[model samples]
Target: MVSETVSVSVPGNVDLAGDLEVPPSSRGVVLFAHGSGSSRHSPRNRAVAEALRRNGWGTLLMDLLTEDEERSDALSGQFRFDIELLGERTAIAVDWLAKHPSTSGLPVHVFGASTGAAAALVAAAERPDRVVSVVSRGGRPDLAGGAVGRVRVPVLLLVGGRDEHVLDLNRKAAEELPETHRVQVVPGASHLFEEPGALEQVAAAARDWFLQSAGSGPG
Candidate 1:
């Protein structure tokens, strides 16, 4: 296993901090785009990353915003909903992953949470060749706007069963996506999947989808 802290440079002369981990004989790399107000250290994302690593995958958990931007967003709630900026930054991170020595040429998957899910979809649409698949957790894919229609890769939309509104949103987004898409509901869970075993279910489903996309899942 190889683990390191990395700095990813995006547009606008900003640097984002990330934690990268690659298992020996990695199958691929999954880039995590955390939701509004979340950071690279998101416990839920970290848990999922750990699961992916244990299964011979590389994971990159990056903060979509710089420290200064985070502080400002915290005060004024200005940047959290900037889906365009978030999407651009996420796409640029994919470029960074493509060029990085450790992750270069590796198939890339995107895991997005909350508003970050919209950004993830945008990134997938923008970098069709670089991103192999995408998984969104309790995400607002509707916020991705028209970019949702342009995504060519497989997409998995995971919503908590009880997160009714978001579930509906995912359904609507799925309608606009390409045929290779699924909207999966996690039963007995809420928006955050705070119930015991709920998050584990998410991690498992994500693992399956990513592996399947990489053609490494069960026959």
Candidate 2:
């Protein structure tokens, strides 16, 4: 059964911002970090949430950008380019989720799309105990640069075959990551995987990775 979605406002840079989703008696909680101007309302991330909830895993799809930041980006397009700020916001949300009653004891995983992937990796590096693993889809993980090496969590990088640019970036990021992680390029898909059946493969691959890495509670 799916637990109701609740607003667990996190103290962001300014006023609090964030939302958490928990599945009933969930095996674990996966936090979603939306990139650029996206927020908790992103359809793609929401779709992934539905899939994860069905698979018995809870989801916390938080917005990396606040309302003001979103407006600023709409005007100047700067938020997506600032990985550090995005990473900081992601870290704060993860910390909040760690303390949220509904998610406190569960394994925490961060699933990032686009630039949020870099932020997720940085958070994993910063809070190893809170974030046990990471999964990236159509992500610009390379944007995280040298931070990948510092992450203790096992990371699974997923890129679409047709998205050559992002695929190459993930390939390079994989080399920087520890040998324990895995990287896969889903066949017959683009960055958005708008193509039929492509996104399904990515979702399945990520689910397996998150479940495998979710140990018996936090380390």
Candidate 3:
């Protein structure tokens, strides 16, 4: 069950756009922090979200950028690289989910792709008490700057084999993270991992990691 029509509006602030799906036996909720020029409508992220839902996990796919911000960033490409802005917006989404009636009180996980991965780490670092775990798919975790060291939650950074550059970056980022986290390199996959069964592996790795870290201390 994918709730394509479902979304969230924060009111006073520009309402964040998203697709929410809650499974009957959802163990926790995973929120998506899309990378540059992307939104909840991203087919790749949506595919992984749906896979998560099938495993009895709830999912929140949200666009961290506002319409105006998104438009400006598309042209300037500045906002996307500004880790602080993306991190703040990602944190807002986490806070909203934690307080919402449908998803309130549930443990939270942030799934970040590409640049979004770094944003997720920043959000997790800022709100360790609320966010339980993190999963980065072909993420640029290093872009989060020094925040990676302060992240208390267990982080799983997934990288593609063919994407050597990202894989190297993720490896380097893992060194900065505390010993509680890990970096998983998937073979035969690249940045987007559009090859057959590659994204599914990313989703599965993320699912297992999130499930393991759900209630664990500092995970």
Candidate 4:
């Protein structure tokens, strides 16, 4: 496998920092969209990315915000909830992946966490031809608003059984998703899935979902 830090240039001359890792023979690439106030360096996301890599899938963990923007957001917490902007950036990253030498020909998948789930949906809606599937880990996909109904790809919404409110939200969001979508609850886990073995279950579920939905055509 090969891993490197990359800078993805988006609109407005913005560059998002990322860590891209591709296995010797990858089935596809999974782009990770972190949740509220998180970045590519998030430990949870890094753990998940490692799991995907072990399964022969490439992974890209990126910070959707610029360093300066992130600094500003740290105080106001404004940009984290800007779903529209986040989605736009995610879509732009998809375009960057298409041109990158390593991931150009691979099928693209999105793994979203928390609010990032909504951004993933919007990205899928915006670039149906590029994204093959989406997976939300304790995500607020409802935040994607109308974009939820527009995503044609198979989506897997993973929620913690103990997180009643978020689970309910996921159920509602699942209804608007394509027929191939589903909501899988990880019993005993909370929002963070910090309990022993909880994160492993999440990684397993995501790996299985990506493998199963890979053959499905574009969203």
TM-scores, one per candidate: 0.97, 0.92, 0.93, 0.97
Model 2 Cα lDDT, one tens digit per residue, 1-219: 434555544454264345566768898888888877778888878878778888888888776666787899999998887888778777887887778788878888899988889999988878877888899988988888677888888888888888898888898888888736877888888888778877677778878988888763343
lDDT against the true structure, each candidate: 0.92, 0.80, 0.86, 0.92
Identify the candidate with maximal TM-score: 4
122-180 per-residue lDDT for model 4 (tens digits): 99999999999999999999999999989989899999989999999999989998658
Which candidate comes out best when scored by lDDT? 4
- Residue 35's C-alpha lDDT in candidate 3? 94
List, residue by residue over 1-219, the lDDT tens digit for candidate 1.
779999988767888999999888899999999999999999999998998888888999999999999999999989999999999999999999999888996889999999999999999999987898999999999999999999988899999999999999999999999748999999989998888998899999999999888863211
**Residue 3 deviation, candidate 3, in Å?**
3.7
Candidate 1 TM-score to native: 0.97
**Per-residue accuracy of model 3 over 35-108 as CA lDDT, tens digit each:** 99788889999899889888888899898777898999989997889999889888888888888766886788
RMSD of every prediction: 2.4, 2.0, 2.0, 0.9
Candidate 4 ranges with C-alpha deviation above 4 Å = none
Clashing pairs in 2: none
The residue ranges of model 1 lying beyond 4 angstroms of the native Cα positions read 216-219
User: Judged by TM-score relative to the true structure, which candidate is superior, 3 or 4?
Assistant: 4
Per-model clash counts, in order, read 0, 0, 0, 0
